[model samples]
Target chain A: MPIITIRLAKGRSVEQKRDLARAITNTVVEKLDVNPEWVTVLFDEFDRENWATAGELHSDKYGKGFGKIGSQEYPK
Target chain B: MPIITIRLAKGRSVEQKRDLARAITNTVVEKLDVNPEWVTVLFDEFDRENWATAGELHSDKYGKGFGKIGSQEYPK
Candidate 1:
C-alpha cells in the first residue's frame, strides 16, 4: 500500500480534500502501477502556530489567512 | 534536515504531542547526528471517516471512540 501524506495549513474544504484524494490516487496508480484501492492520501492540516521555517513560526512570519489562499511559502 | 511524520487517529491531547515531539527529536538527534532544531516532527491526525484499511473506512469498521483510547489498531 502507498500512503501519501500531505502537510498543509488547515482550513481546506472537504471538496478540496475529495479532489486531492482522487487526483493523488490516480497519479499514484499511473506512476507506481498500483491499484487505486491500494492508494491512500492523508492530509496533515497544521495550524500556523505549529508550523515553522527558519526558526520562525508561520503565524508570526506569514500572518493569518496565508495558507487558505496560498502564498509564497504555499504556492498554488 | 530530517522530518518524521506520525500518522495516527485523531483526539490526542497536546500534552502527548509535546512529549512525543521532545522524545522523537532526541532520538533523531542522537541517531542521525542532526541538531534538535533540524528535526521536525509532524502529526497527521486523521478522523475515522477519512482513514481506511482493506477498502473499509475506520468509521464503519471500528465504529466511534476507538481511536481516542488504545485499540487493536492503535496501541498506546
Candidate 2:
C-alpha cells in the first residue's frame, strides 16, 4: 500500500488531480505490478497558511506568516 | 502550520471523521488559538494495506504485506 501525498502549488483543478492520481495508479500497476483499485490517492488543497518549513511558514513564504503546513512525520 | 495525521483504526464513519476533525480544529483554535479555515485535515483510509509500522507493514500486521505506507520524513 503506497499512499503518497503530493503537496504542489495550489490552484490545481479537479481534472488535473484525477489525471495525476490515474497516472500514479497506472505506474504502480505496471512497474510494481499491483491492482489499480487498491491504489488510492487524496489531494489536499490548502491555503499557504496551513504549511510551514524551518522557522518561517508558507504564509511567510510569500510575505506574512498567515498559514503554514508543517510537513513532518515519524516512522512508527 | 501544523498538519497532523491521525492513523486510527480503520472503518471509521464519515461522521466520526468529521467530528474528530472538528474537535482537533477546535482544540487548536482554543488552546493554540489558530484560525478555523486555516485548519485542514485529510483522512487516509485503507484496508490495513496502506500503512506501516516499524519493519512489518499494516497488511503484514494482519497476514501478508499487501500494501505499506512507509511513514518517514526529513526535517527541512
Candidate 3:
C-alpha cells in the first residue's frame, strides 16, 4: 500500500481534501503503476501553536489565519 | 529533519499523544543520532468514515466508537 501522508496547517476545506486526494491518487497511480485503490492519502493538520520553525511557533511568527493560505514553511 | 507520522484512528487522549511523542522522539534520536529538536512527531487521526481496509470503510466494518480502542488494522 502506498500511504501518502501530507502534513499541512489546519483549516483546509473538505473540498480541498477531496481534490487533493483525487489528484494525488491519480499521480501515484500513473507514476508508480499501482492501482488507485491501493493508494491512501492521509492529511495531518496541525495547529499553529503545535507547529514550530527555528524554535519559533507559527502562531507567533505568522499571526492568525495562516493555514487558510499556507504556512510559513510553504508560502503560497 | 526526520518527520515521523503516525496514522491512527481518532479519539486517543492527549496523554497518549504526549507519551508517544516522547517515546518516539527518544527512539529516533537514539537510532538516527539526530538532535531532539530536529525530529517531528505528527499524529494523524482519521475518522472511521475516512479510513478503509479491504475495500470496506471502517465505520461500516467496525460500527461506531471503534476509534476509542485502536482499529481493525491495529488490534491493541
Candidate 4:
C-alpha cells in the first residue's frame, strides 16, 4: 500500500480534492503495481502562518490566498 | 528540508499535536541533518469513513474514536 500525503496552501475546493485524489491514486497504482483499494491519499492543508520557506513564514511572504497567480514559487 | 506528514484518526487535542510536532521535528533534524526551522510537520486527520483496511472502511470496522484502547491494530 502506498500512502501519499500532499501538502498545499489551503483554499482548494472539494472538487479539486476529489480530482487530486483520483489522479494520485491512478498514478500510484500504475507505477507501483498496487491495488486502488490499498492506496491512501491524504491532503495536508496548511495555513500560510504555519508554513515557512527560508526561515520566513508564508504569511509574511505571500500575504494570503493560494495558487500560482501571485506566488513566487508554488505553481498551480 | 524534510516535510513530514502524520496521518491519524481525528480528535487529538492541540496539546497532543504540539508535543508530536516537537518530537518529530527533533528526530528529523537529527536524523536528516536538517535545521529545525527548515522542517515542516503536518498532521493529516482522517475520518474513519475515509480510511479503510482489508477492503473495509474503518468506520465499519472500528466504530468511532482514536488510539489503542479498543482498536485491534492501532496501538496507543
Worst 10 residues of 1 chain B by lDDT: B67-76
On a 0 to 1 DockQ scale, where is model 2?
A: 0.04
Clash number for each model: 0, 11, 0, 0
Backbone clashes in model 3, listed as residue pairs: none
Candidate 4 chain A, run of 10 with poorest lDDT: A67-76
Worst 10 residues of 4 chain B by lDDT: B49-58
Off by over 4 Å in 3: A67-76, B1-6, B11-44, B48-76
Give the per-residue lDDT of model 4 (tens digit) for A1-76: 7777677887766556666677778777888888988887666678889999899997888877788646444334
Ranking by lDDT: 4, 1, 3, 2
Candidate 1, residue A67: lDDT: 49
Model 1 chain A poorest ten-residue lDDT run = A67-76
Q: What is residue B69's positional error in candidate 3, in angstroms? A: 17
Candidate 1 lDDT tens digits, A1-76: 8987677887665555666666777777898898877877666678889999999998887776544433434333
Tens digits of per-residue lDDT, candidate 4, B1-76, equal 7889888988777888999999999999999888899999999787655554433445555777777634444334
Give the per-residue lDDT digits (tens) of candidate 2, residues A1-76.
4454544335444665576566645644543334676555555556556655676666656543222333321112
Give the Cα error of residue A58 in candidate 2, in Å: 1.5
TM-score of chain A of each: 0.83, 0.64, 0.84, 0.86
Query: Which sections of candidate 2 miss by over 4 Å?
Result: A63-76, B1-76
Native interface contacts kept by each candidate, as a fraction? 0.09, 0.00, 0.00, 0.04
Cα lDDT for residue B76, model 1? 46
